[model samples]
Target: MNQPVSGFSKKSKAEKIEWLAENYLQNNLRSVQVLKNYWNDDPSLQQLHDDFIENTLSNYYLPFGIAPNFLINEKLYALPMVTEESSVVAAASNAAKFWLERGGFKAEVISTEKNGQIHFNFFGSEKVIEAFFEEIKPKLHSSIQAIEKNMKARGGGLLALSLVDKSHILEGYFHIHATFETLDAMGANFINTCLEQMAHTFEEEARNFEAFQKKVTYPEVVMSILSNYVPECLVRAEVSCNVEELTTKHHEGKHFAEKFVRAIEIAKTETRRAVTHNKGIMNGVDAVVLATGNDFRAVEAGVHAYAARNSYYSSLTHAKIEDDVFTFWIELPLAVGTVGGLTSLHPLTKLAFEILQKPDAKELMQILAVAGLAQNFAAIRSLVTTGIQKGHMKMHLMNILNQLHATEAEKEKAMEHFMKNTISHSAVVDFLGKLRL
Candidate 1:
């Protein structure tokens, strides 16, 4: 039987580990050792990691890799990627090199607007609430001035405040919808702070107002939070070249371009294919987002919402061929920050920024968008020509070798054999068996 324990967080790291091992792990020494093995060698670094979250045990690691020769907006970058997938880095690098010989990727930040809400329950007259909102709009901005001081000095802060009436849809539901521009920061904390302050001021001021005082209808402040759906904080990245430039090993340039456009059209019409197609794009976007220590989850949420913005989910990347030129591009809402949070805290995050030449928020947005575009191009290229599994299974060979517990000599022979032969689990196993015999 499991039991809840109080003061669990107050326990020391060793004590917490011991309790977990004893209670849940059945006192398995190997399990305990595995956790301990992942701890940082330096005590200070271990402490820093432990402080990052609650109930810290040991660090979970993902492979950090680099895809070089990415030419975005006439500048070169070696994009840092952190992922567990075997083929993502390789695919991104292939696309980067492919485009490098042509014109490279072009990227731009379309907007930088973020939003939040102060949700509340108001049972007052609709007319009264609307008039009150009009009166309190300026005060809402004034209340959060102290919080916005530094953000404004950097040319980023609260931009607009509006009252939204949702009482018709959901009884007594009203909100203060606020917009912000946080510049280089992701601005979650900043936007939420302003929202909460504005909410507090609204409630306090409403109590003193004559209509509210006479009628005793006080709006109940429910919550204040930032929205991850940042449709306005968008970036676009594209790669374009003459149709002749799209020639690959297996197909002529014009034929390849025709097949590629048709493939995108299928993804646009089919939900199942669109889901996987967009997921491939995120493989590149998320890798860079993680390496740079930005919020990949938030980026994912915003991007998927944008995909379904037209009442049906569809491909994030689009392909077109016209005037003897083939173009492939993606435009997505990515609200990621270059500073603050893990970017300044994690050592590798600092290194990632240095490798990127210290791009600002807009520059980082552009680079991330290009990463996604490159990844999609590689995936679609593979799908339209040689098929996806050939490369994917080849890249997955090491994982299979590790699972089979093959020796160094056996792995070397297996690698050589698979280079000339098709890779499959049964094939590898049979080869190993024959080698053993």
Candidate 2:
């Protein structure tokens, strides 16, 4: 059994790796070498990565790829994507190309409001608490004026603040809900700072309130933090073309459109299917979000929550056929920024923005929504026509070849064979076995 040791974090990098390898990795020589091999050669660059987190190991990597010809808002762009999945970038690129001749994608920013909350408990009379909140709301806004100055100067800052009484739901529970317009930054730090300050001011004033002073205990602050669920910060992206234009070599346009709409309908009414349906959309959203150095996890949480806003999770993408036209679209909350976090710090993130023509926060939101919409269109198009496995397995062939340790000649032969034959793990393995003979 392994035992916990003291001073693990205090240990040097080599020492920490040594101890981890011995205790946790069972002294696997290859594992230790693999970990060390990923370390950066430049000490300065390594230090930059090290500063990102504690107990830093060597850098982990994902493929950075581009999905080109994404036309949004009458402008063309090449979207950067970072992912391990094989077909995501390909699917997105194919979708972008498919729509390019059909007028590409249309997108818009629905809103740009983010929010946070300060939750507290008060055992005082509800009427008294309401009066105290009315009096203290102005002070709460004034308390964060200094903090909001820089943000305000940039045309972004606190938008509104209000007191919410949740005591009916949870006894003694009340909250101060605050909204913001962060402009070009995912202002977690800024919002968090203001929330903490407001919480401080709230408690201080409550402690001195005459009604509270009359009681033995006053309102107790639970916590202050920014919410990732920014439903108001949303964007919509869509593609539309004549149903006749939707025809592929494999399927007729009218039939294809009918099947595509049915697939979305199934996802909308079915929870299990919706989860995977939405996950496919996130495959595109997350890839672009990661490539741009934005918070994909937060975006995922907010989007999933939005999907369930009607009390049941469903597809994020919707499709319709009207007047001989086929339309597909997606609308979801996305809180992304272009000026803060790793956007400025990471070299690749900087390149991604340059590739995107340097969009602001709102533009980035629109572009991301388009990427997601395009991805879903490609996936549904494939699913309703050729089936998902044919393309997915074709893209996955190289990964399987690498895992099987096929030589150059074997890989070339395998690729040609799979093109003519079914591409399945068992079939590939059997063919390789015979080829080795």
Candidate 3:
């Protein structure tokens, strides 16, 4: 049994690795070597990564890929995506190409307001509390003026502050809901700072208010924080063409369009299908989100919540065919930043922004929505025509070969053989065995 190490974070990188190897890895030399092998060759770059977080052992890596020929709003873009999954970039690239001849993707920012809350409990009279909130609302806004000075100078800052009474849900519960425009930054730290300042000011004012002094219990602040759910921060992306233009060598255009519409309908009506269907959309959305150093986890949480906003989980993408016209679109609530957090600090993230032509926050939102729509278009096209497994398994072939420890010559032969044969783990193993024999 291993004991909990004391002051583990205080140890140097070498000492921490040695301790981990001894206690957790049974002092395996190869395992220790594996950790060191991933360290950056450049010392300054390695130090930069180490300073990003505590307990830094080694840098984890994912492939940084680009999907070219994305035409959004009549502008061309090559999207940068970072992911570990195979075929995601390929699928996005294929989708982009397919749409290029059909007017590509059209995307626009619907809104750009983010929000935070100062939650508190007031055990006093409802009327008194409401009156107090109305009186102190302006004061709360003034409290955060200095904190939001820079953001305001850039045409973004606090938009509104309102009091929400949730005493019906929980006794004595209320919140100060605040909306903001954060411009080109993700603004987590900025929003949070403003919320805390307002919360402090709110509590302080409540203490001095005559009505609150008359009450036995004063207003108590439970917490102050920014919300990941930004339904107001939204973007819409779509692609459309004549229904007959969807034709490919494998399937007729009319048949493909109807089948694609049916597939989206199934996803909307069924929860299980909706989960996987939306996950496919995220495979594209999250890859771009990660590459640009935005918060994928926040985007994921907010997106799923938006899907269920109608009280049931449903597909994020929609399709329609009417009067010989076929249109597909997705409206996503994405709050992404282009100027703050890891966006500026991470070397690859800076390069990703450059690759994207340095879009502002609104433009980034548009790009993210387009990526999701393109991804879903590719996935549904594959599913409705040749089936998903054929293309997915083909992309997964390299990983299988590496797992089998196939030589360069063996891998080439295996790729050729699988091109005309069904691909499965067992089938690959058998083919490799036969080749070796």
Candidate 4:
């Protein structure tokens, strides 16, 4: 029965909320109250959040936490994380502590290249189009001089340009592919702007080309945009220690290392296992990506694409035991930036950067890779040892308790009881029911 309302964006916040409440929320007063309750108290701060997007509603908050004692490349750091998952921060902190004594984590940036494309339709001879592209390639670079000036001054700019003919895949399809170095910024806007300019110039030049005029065919631009699949922007992070040093109370070092390597191999070979295995890695990767105000969705897309680059999806993390040493590492594409987008606008994001010691884009990529590696190590370590449920459910207990509306005394008792007993939603409910009785 809800009807679309025009000019919703121009409406005041209160008006928008009222319309939404009436049209969709069934006029629930409690729902309306809930929306207002989450609004920031500080007027300036609320406005800042409001300006972030259109039709601002109440803020949705995630817990911002710190995983301390991360030693990457001989430098100590405490990573900032934002996630609703109860076990993520606990798992990351545990992994950081475990690796701290194992010579810490080592990370390095392998490359920093991003690219975009200008898709156009060229219904003409391929040879003529090729010749025209070669002649105009230099002009394509020069067309973006004004746009690339600032980026070039910072030691990053257009890297290369090429003509790609995909008429075989889709008839009359061709594109101008361009590569770039965005430096410290995520460079999405910069790259996109440059692409738009080049696209404009490309279409303009096509009209005057002798071949196009003679053949009565023109290259019609479809779109110009940057690609999120940045495989060339990669980082590798790893941790290694003697096999004997992996010994814990539950398992011997040799057995544990062998089992760990086998688990990773299973993930690599099996798609079902690989999906969940990679998801655990993202639990860590996404937390830091969100905390630092980078686009987690973009990072996720690019990373998953990389995992499937070999024609099959596999684990992002790898493990090996050689010469009495167990090494665990992950190499993935992370096209994140430290100086632009929400990184500067969001207060918590800014704080996250400060917590990370203000790393540049490359350094941030290393940190993100290390976070994913640490998370995977922790998850696989648990899966091969205590079983994932034991620690994960224990961490999830607080959420269940909060859901059941347990009081302070009840929560304290529940924690102690679950520490000794297995945890499940029904079990927690039963325990609280008995305690209340």
lDDT of 1 by residue, 1-437 (tens): 86777899999988998899888999999999999999999999999899989999999999999999999989999999999999999999999999999989999899999999999999989888888889988999899889999999999999998889999999999988889999999988888888989989999989888888789898889999999999999999999999998876778999999999999999999999999999999999999999999999999999999999999999999989989999898999989898899999999999999999999999999999999999998999999999999899999998998888899999999999999899999998998889889
RMSD of each: 1.1, 1.1, 0.7, 0.8
Instruction: Tell me model 1's lDDT, rounded to 2 decimals.
Output: 0.93
Candidate 2: what lDDT? 0.92
lDDT of 3 by residue, 1-437 (tens): 99988999999999999999999999999999999999999999999999989999999999999999999999999999999889899999999999999899999888889999999998778899899999999999999989999999999999999989999999999998999999898989999999999999999998899987876568999999999999999999999999889988898999899999999999999999999999999999999999999999999999999999999999999999999899999999998899878999999999999999999888999999999999899899999999999999999999999999999999999999999999999999999999999
- Which residue pairs show collisions in model 1? none
lDDT of 4 by residue, 233-337 (tens): 999999999999999888999999999999999999999999999999999999999999999999999999999999999999999998999999999998999
- Displacement of the residue 200 alpha carbon in candidate 4, Å: 0.7
> Candidate 2: misplaced stretches above 4 Å?
none
Superposed model 3: Cα runs more than 4 Å off = none
Give the C-alpha miss distance for residue 45 in model 1, angstroms. 0.8
